[model samples]
Target chain A: MARVDRSLVTHLPLFAGVKPDDLEEILREARSARYPKNSAIFEQGADAQSFFLLLHGHVRAAKTTPTGEQIVVRYVAPGETFGLATAIGLAHYPATATAVDDSIVLIWPTAAWPRLAERFPSLAANTLQTVGARLQESHTRILEMSTQQVEQRVAHALLRLAKQSGKKLDQGIEIDFPISRQDIAQMTGTTLHTVSRILSGWESQGLVESGRQRIILREPHRIVVLAERSADSGAA
Target chain B: MARVDRSLVTHLPLFAGVKPDDLEEILREARSARYPKNSAIFEQGADAQSFFLLLHGHVRAAKTTPTGEQIVVRYVAPGETFGLATAIGLAHYPATATAVDDSIVLIWPTAAWPRLAERFPSLAANTLQTVGARLQESHTRILEMSTQQVEQRVAHALLRLAKQSGKKLDQGIEIDFPISRQDIAQMTGTTLHTVSRILSGWESQGLVESGRQRIILREPHRIVVLAERSADSGAA
Candidate 1:
């Protein structure tokens, strides 16, 4: 067991309304661990015996098809929870999570969830809210994929990334992590070639800058305009 | 206020592990209401002041595109809850829900959710589990849409519907509700013409029976076969 940090409880969304003493009691059962970039935190279909809270770095949640195609579902940032399927009674992890960078995370055993939930009703409520929010975001992504063109989807994805983890650079707001064109393609439900072409076009038009595994938004509003533009224009 | 049913609490998945007395106490704050077929129970983006539990008949949860195309997201059956978005702190409904047939539902004010959740930890945990399950399903659908061909998508959609609310008929397993070809189109991300043609082909092969507004699966395994078949066959 790791020493419980009173401030860490305040940082986690699930423990928002819980008192520091209550969180300390809960965290007595938790341990802090670190993983290097590209390390598999957990594998798909593995028994979900634990849940995690990221304290630093990024993680990617993904699923793999039988044909070996990988689809990136979500990216977890610091202060967010992962392995939530366990909280919901799932026996196995639905997707594989890999550390995107050197990451520090707080780990909680599955056995502790029910006890903590019983003790602090607010924790349970907050967990439900977190799941609900994620579901809504997933639904929005589904609607976009079903209706929006590829370029539009890419633009929207970039905006979402900006909102979550953007860092202002000399030129514009840059997504503060390493992300390849292929990663964007997977997230946007498009082919890598399509993502590359559209990004190159945007780069030429001064809408964004793309380089070795990074994207910087030169004009965020312009990207929004492109995303909201009618598909009839054939720009997609 | 209608007399609340003590038995109703047992039927709700959210109240699965709750004590009978506690459940009855929660139910005292609920009201039973009925809606005629095709009546809107709630609209997307409406103030989500309450949550509902279906007791009889069926409800369809759907979202409409700005272009006026309606997509059926899911169907709520007896004992299932809708409008849970509000319970999880959403300010408005993310999707509209309507009665597919004359339906009876239990309505609980949003304010009651936190109270009930606090008093019965099981209810909160179950709600979170439901949200998690939906998120997994949505992710699976996204994977299907991105990688699977149209025919596979259709087959998968049918399987999902059957799992949710299929009824055994002389012909096969009927979907247990009315759904237009257009609804199938929206669910499968295809056109009505394409859905019609595919169903017609399936009907000819005795894989399914299609009526004016219902689909009966004659051989569900065949649908599974279609869903699993390689896209290289060009059956789509």
Candidate 2:
């Protein structure tokens, strides 16, 4: 693998506060790879041999239940880290990571982790902060699933996606990636038919615009109101 | 406050691999406090001024929804860490932590994290691993909520609690903590009535023994079979 330029990653939060020399050493140990759209980056239960940083495009992390059902755990955006099973003491990947779009990522063998973390204390600190943020996000979703209504849960999911990867447009903020109603269903713990019905209802109310593999929040404020509204009949 | 003895925490996972002198220094920065059972350790959205380690007793971390419903996030067992809001970059506690039993905790102000983490690299690595493990657990729960039946979810929750804090008895493993049906309801994202009905059915079938504020799994193998049973009419 060719050496990556320091300029490519000095701006990343993972590299923040790391000296240029340390960053050079870290970058040298990484090899870059690309996945075509919809290609699997890694599979659940496979040996987690490497950690990754998405340098370009988006990735989806989905967990397959024991019963053969898949749940959309979360999405990974550019400059975010994933496939950190070894860092968390797990020997196998807990979820399968797939490229939602043609994507590039920097890969480092898990064997290099201890050395890298020891040499660059900031790296561990940064990763800790990142993991912390994601834990909070997961907790937020759990709360939404447990206490909020289905429509509210869907609204929250869209809002979170928009916040994470939205592209501001005239209509509002487009999700900026190809996402289907099935993805939203798995995200919010609802069935696809129920998500479709809720989206259709929102479309009629001018709250959102949905199309094949696309979603745009036309009235984000209104959606927020719905998301925060008190429980109706409860989870769908 | 009197200084806590070093021996009190030498066996904790958080202190693993930390040198004795370093442990002493870390202990010097912490003050111990006791929380009476059923008392609030910290409220949601309060300034996250400190991080904590449970020295003795259990703590329940619950998130209260906007509509006033409380969801039990998880239970904290002795020797576990909690209140790490600042470590994750949060300015306030995300959930309210309450002592389920009279508890003693070692507290350290958030201001000490950076210096301590930098000086003791193991601290950062340990915390990263801790948060990573929790992030995986949260994802597991999310998967259960999205894909599993209510009975399965409850079974998983019980199994988890038992693993975390169970004591062996003549009949079966008893969850060592005082967990009520309502707590189980909050943990499994089901109504109290639903949890009660399921437990009653299990009791008659010799799967578990339930009582006020206590439960025992008399037939864990059968419950595991139920938990792994595929899609019972899809997520009650």
Top candidate (DockQ): 2
Give the alpha-carbon lDDT of every model.
Answer: 0.87, 0.90
The segments of candidate 2 whose C-alpha lies over 4 angstroms from its true place after superposition are: A233-236, B233-236
TM-score for chain A in each prediction:
0.96, 0.96
True contacts kept of 1: 0.60
Native contact fraction, candidates in order: 0.60, 0.90
A6-104: candidate 2 lDDT, tens digit per residue = 676899998899999989999889999999999999999999999999998999999997668888989999999999998887899999999999999
The pairs that clash in candidate 2 are: none
**What TM-score, over all chains together, does every model reach?**
0.96, 0.95
lDDT for each residue of candidate 1 in B70-156, tens digit (9 for 90 to 100): 667788988888999766779899899999989999999988887788877888888888888888988888888888888899999
Residue-level lDDT of model 2, residues B113-208, one tens digit each, is 889988998888888889999999999999889888799899999999988988888899899878888999999898999999999989988899
Residue pairs of candidate 1 with colliding backbone atoms: none
RMSD of each: 1.7, 2.5
Q: How many residue pairs clash in each candidate?
A: 0, 0
| Model 1: per-residue Cα lDDT over A98-217, one tens digit each | 998899899998888888888899888888888888888888888888778898999999999998989988899999888898888889888899999999999999999889889999
